[model samples]
Target: MWLSNSSCEEVVVSAWGSGSEIGVEGDILRKVEKRVKELGQWEKDVFGNVKSELSRLRKEIAKEERIAMGDKNTRYFHSCATKRFRKNSMEGIRDEGGVWRTSQEDIGEVMVNYYKSLYTSTDRRVSTGILDFVSTLIDEEMNESLCREFEASEVASALQQMAPLEEPSPDGMPPLFYQHFWSTVNNDVTSPILSWLNSEGLNGLIKKAELQGEIHGYSLCRRGPKLTHLLFADDSFIFCKATMEECDNVLEILKKYEEASGQKMNRSKTSLFFSKAIPEEVKHEIKAALGVPEILHYEKYLGLPSLLGRGKKESFDYIKEKVWRKLQGWEAKLLSQVGREVLIKAVIQAIPTYTMRCFKLLASLCNEIEALIKRFWWGQRGDRRKVHWVKWEEMTKSKTIGGMGFQDLAMFNDSLLAKQAWRLLNNKTSLFYKVFKARFFPNSSLLEAADSRMGSYAWKSILRGRDIIQRGAIWRVGSGEKINIWQQLWLPRKHPTIPLICPLESFENHTVDSLIDPSTRTWNEQLVDGLFVEEDAMLIKKIPFSRNVAEDTLYWPYSTSGNYTCKFGYRFFKEEEELQLNAQTPPICHKHVWKEVWQMQAPPKIKKIFFGEHARMYFQQNMH
Candidate 1:
């Protein structure tokens, strides 16, 4: 058989099974459903009933697939079967010694021990003068929060943030358990935690952020899992279709939730976000129904810019405002050069990290950002200016390379995007990765995934990182059964410019091992030559076939070291950025050197007149 019933992915999927073919094609399934349409279908045959059950399951899966794939009813049988192997639930992890701990306490201890090793005590003594200065830096609000009393509403909100089915702690209880026993055990639970946090346990909250309120899901009032609103601390997200029904559902849920809990949704502050674009006429209709105006996109979500334009000019403009806002603040004027460097690195750059993790930021956007930082670095406060001694590029280089170790933003952006790619590859158990697998890529490997205009911008950004990921990915070939000769990236130490040995047509949907002599565990020369071009045919002889193992895995190209880090991607991008940026433009760093001289402990008159190194000449060169 060209395709096997054992699994759907074993066959190459050309297209999805058409809608018309549903409940009819795929032979064995057709016979079962045909009998069910007739009378007394279950009583007809023992084998036929099983097929009928499968037919119903297939129909359900088909409908869900269509919904998830944006109403596109396309997926091969093997592809559907392959998706079944994904683990949607926690399966617990093995210890470093390689033994799976089934008990919850054992697992908890393993996790605790693992994390404990990552921490080190900062036990150095500091002078009273330095300690007093640092203590002065702590905002008054922070101290007030430490001693703040826990309210009933606050505790409830905290409970609401936790996942209902989360793993039980060492105490054998999840948030769900506390929520159920709240009335009877309210004081017992609340008093100790409140006392601890107020007294000496403030750092515990930061260390264990796992303390969430309640998991968002369908309310008991709703039968289906129709989550309309989600609350995390103060922020609220209201989801609905651009119709009266959406408004009706949301309002009804809010009314009920308000009566039960003291908290209520702020109608005035509430905003609606549509997953799809809506017509202006329909927008007015939704507004009339919901009493909230429809918006194109929020200015920011969770401190990150959400739904910004894909273009460099539009997308990067927000970052400029963010950088300027930080520099314009009162703190900026008070800080020294070293203090400004820390603020720029720790605060300004950190602002865009969450957004950058999922985006391949434009080169010019990075440049605009660095330009603002460059101005700040040189003591440019508003229109007031200072001299710059070095190029931004030189300062952005590693500390060992005559620079301040300020990160090159362009390379940092690539590293962030590559981290997303790395997550898709390594974290298959993650919900996002699983959903992605179920929808767009049911039948293909990451390297073989086809581009789609229908894909979301975030997905497209992740796709952009695929090239970097592919460059670093090498396959650990075992049985060689899952390995595809033409489609997958398997070879180590091979350039990407090198084409596949055999044409897609020549291979005709065969595994890599098909070209090998199974007995000898070597390439079959005749089979290889007939399919591959002459040069590629010779190269095939050099490729090794593993005889000792049959399990296949994707290995990192940095080595078979088998670990995850964005450092490899960062290094590659750094090298590429150095070549491109250095070749294209002059250094922008030296423009601010004269300003730094003025900052020195020198006479005001001398500082004003002394122009550092070719200042007038440099300005003249840049003017035209």
Candidate 2:
């Protein structure tokens, strides 16, 4: 029952039937193949039943009974036992004296001594002056948040945040085990964690320091928000001027925090980055004062460059290498076309997605990535090229149309970058937005801000994304003061939201507010009708005003929610390209025909064949 006949038949039939158009099979041979699929399904069913019975037996055995059964009695237990010992074994340990100890006794003694030293505390004294420098950053609201009771959801989320296949816990269960069996273990796991959190309990101290003028933070521009510290989970980045006083203050704050919170800093892991302007002697002095080594550049933080320099391609070449490694392990020759399609979309395409969300990759690099995917799709390996039957551009079109629903990497990257830009457009309260706004456009809004030659690579990339938003986004009327009636696209209509009638010289600078009655906070019908043509006037009058007369804001009309999404943004560009292409070339298939092909009762694999063959025949007969 685990492997049903109908389900297995569908998968096998689809894989086998994909090439049925190229060669014809007789009714008897088709019947025999159908029987073979059924047999394969039945064989899988038999195996599933046996596996189920074995699992039941293993579960029913008590802890004592399992130990008595021994490794020799069950291959499953034997494998688990062997793997545990092999992976967990300690071969040797190097002592502090730089000698490698091979014996078990020496290794145990070394471990004990190391942990003893690690846990042991040294006498420390804090001057009253240092304590005075530390301000009261935690308020009543923050204190309450720290002291609040824990929820079951928080417990589950913490466990889920851990890597699924990471090393096993003390109980020999990896995170994957708990995640897989969460439903069964939920109450048991939740109760203990909640109890501990309720018993024990839990700011940006650097910001308060900056406010008190005890410390200073680096800024990109004079007007921008100063960059003091960045914190995400356990990672922290601290910025301050290169001075002994500043360094002492920072160290004191950290010491005070550690003493109060019982959480110790990993000094070995902490690193200091100094600007080139700082003198070499001063750098060394600060490093000694802070008790952390100085580094020219960080290796990586959260799997991304902490600071991107002039060499952008070199900085991001790792993405290309990662994609290549993924392709190397996959056997294109063994996988079905459908299987390949799934892997390419889900795995390969997803590899660059995280990086793309933060940076706009070079177009050449995007093309190179797409080339690797194209080769794999056509069964290419190790410099052996396969003839590409269709253009990559055609392949990226929607499945409901004539092509596979593959992403166009370049457009997809822009779409992702546009999403970041959209966030800045809307989330003005975010730290990122505030910092960028101060640095790049202190006086102007993101929409009206122009690209500058002096801008950083990230700033420039965001501006490129802004181009897409500008094309699709229109003003959602609120107060109507910000939207110009003749110039801006404010009317909620399918086409030509702006005025069709040319504006008279007298009314050239009129805003939407000119047509709004101030008393009623509604459209002045007489003014609207006089200014625009009937269609434009009708659309303008239909737009409802906010009850409270809210400020005018930008919105994308293509989406029902009116908010920008990467999916909708990417699709909008692709659809626009299709529209332009259709305008130039004669149509091969009607909209209703393609709709029917997609809506057919046939399986998707067969439906693809139907569309492919029809398109091929149509092109051969007409375009050729």
Candidate 3:
């Protein structure tokens, strides 16, 4: 049955029988309209039923669409897709003669010629001066092996390394097809890829330029690594001295790269970012020389600022605006309480997560975001004010602890930023860490790093995150040589970092390594028992030592993997806050029973309703 749900029609068409017969929909709808118009009660009932059915159908359709998109953030995905389309759609191209080619045929010709010039190489001989600088690291035997003809076994081995479902070539055959039908297509595949079929790619050209000293790169600090360029997939960021000579050299590198790689440079899309030290006249000359746009202040790279200036809150305000826009959508108003919760957690909270991972947002901004979410949660739309039944702080608690399990944005933000600090602590070998270490705190480790008074905003944000790490991180006992028993948090237990009883005057200066027996890589049980109180002794004795005598390592005890994660970090702070609050206030009666009520396996709305009813009944009976 072909049922059309077109809004323009008075009534939709539907088939009654299983075959091609049409239903008597016209007569039925006429009768329904007549009955609906005749009696006021009947009219009301019929209109209400129709409205309900229509709403249900719309909801079902929306649900199916969401499922088909394969993303819970369907609105977010749609927004991105729309933005990408607007940005990527090419209206026209300017030819070499400076005339716009708007027609498809003209544009096609321009593209073909542009790429043809890039791929087609001139028969110019290479200069011996440039080639002389190249070092031959390969031996004669290794060179011969590399230049040898390919074998079927070698071809099959290479094919096996590729993912089976990887995107196919122009032939529309994926890796899986070749692997599965190897017996049938082996001959056709192995013969074409000769060793002589070779060309220098963009990377090779860049490396040669670097080796010949034709290009220079800047360093984060005097002793840091000189970063010439950074390439993430298709996006590229090139660094060089702000001079006419360096700019010319960079342009020349790009010119050679285009010829070798069959890729045309999009000058209109390219931009040059200059430091404030560079003169305005020099900036103009450089922009004109490169034939690219000039970014006066900053531009976004992968949705984040490529360069951050003094106003951090202004730079990151887009995240807040994005959340507001998402909440303002009509779908948000239609969503149920459960739906709103999912949207807030999965989409709205995640909007800032990527930004938070790199920078610590202002406390004011976090509170504003929380206010927007809270307003939506309490059914306050536009100018209409609604009474908030529960406080946001109470709602931020876990569901099992008599709250809605909503994320506390400020805490979550700190946790996400702490992840960056965690990375810095664990991955000291990474280029990011090396650069930051050289610039901010070359003399100290991340744990001991003091705030740099004249550091970048990013450095300052990371230090804020380091505070959270400082609070929650405890050392895992290994060889324990570097850990001090008094200053550091080495104990495995939650509450206390040190022994319950104060350390003895002589023991305060000792390392954890002093407590371990040298002969058997185990804790000196007798010494531990004698030195501390019973409680401290039991906790210290329970901590197992590594058999191989590894170095003492810091770990977050809240997580199973001993690594600091955003979830565990936020929870740790929340628990600490709760502990402090509990200590200040009197204890509640039958707290465990109330906790059970919150933890019940029912819909949140139903549970809230049941609790309200139960509370009312209890108060009424007590009053009687």
Give lDDT tens digits, candidate 2, residues 274-390: 776889999889888778877544355577766778878878888999999998889999887767888899899999999888888988899999999999998998887777767
TM-score list, all predictions:
0.50, 0.64, 0.67
User: Considering lDDT, which of the candidate structures 1 and 3 is the better prediction for this target?
Assistant: 3
Best by TM-score: 3
| Each candidate: RMSD | 28.8, 22.8, 19.6
Clashing pairs in 3: none
How many clashing pairs does model 3 include? 0
The best-first sequence of candidates by TM-score reads 3, 2, 1
lDDT of 1 by residue, 145-195 (tens): 766776766877788788976996544445664565456445434544454
- Flag regions of model 2 displaced more than 4 Å: 1-214, 255-269, 288-298, 495-501, 584-608, 611-623
Clashing pairs in 2: none
Cα displacement (Å) at residue 213, model 2: 5.4
Question: Model 3, 398-449: lDDT tens per residue?
Answer: 7555566788888888888898998888777688999998888788888778
Off by over 4 Å in 1: 1-241, 275-282, 296-298, 309-312, 330-337, 381-389, 434-443, 481-551, 559-561, 575-624
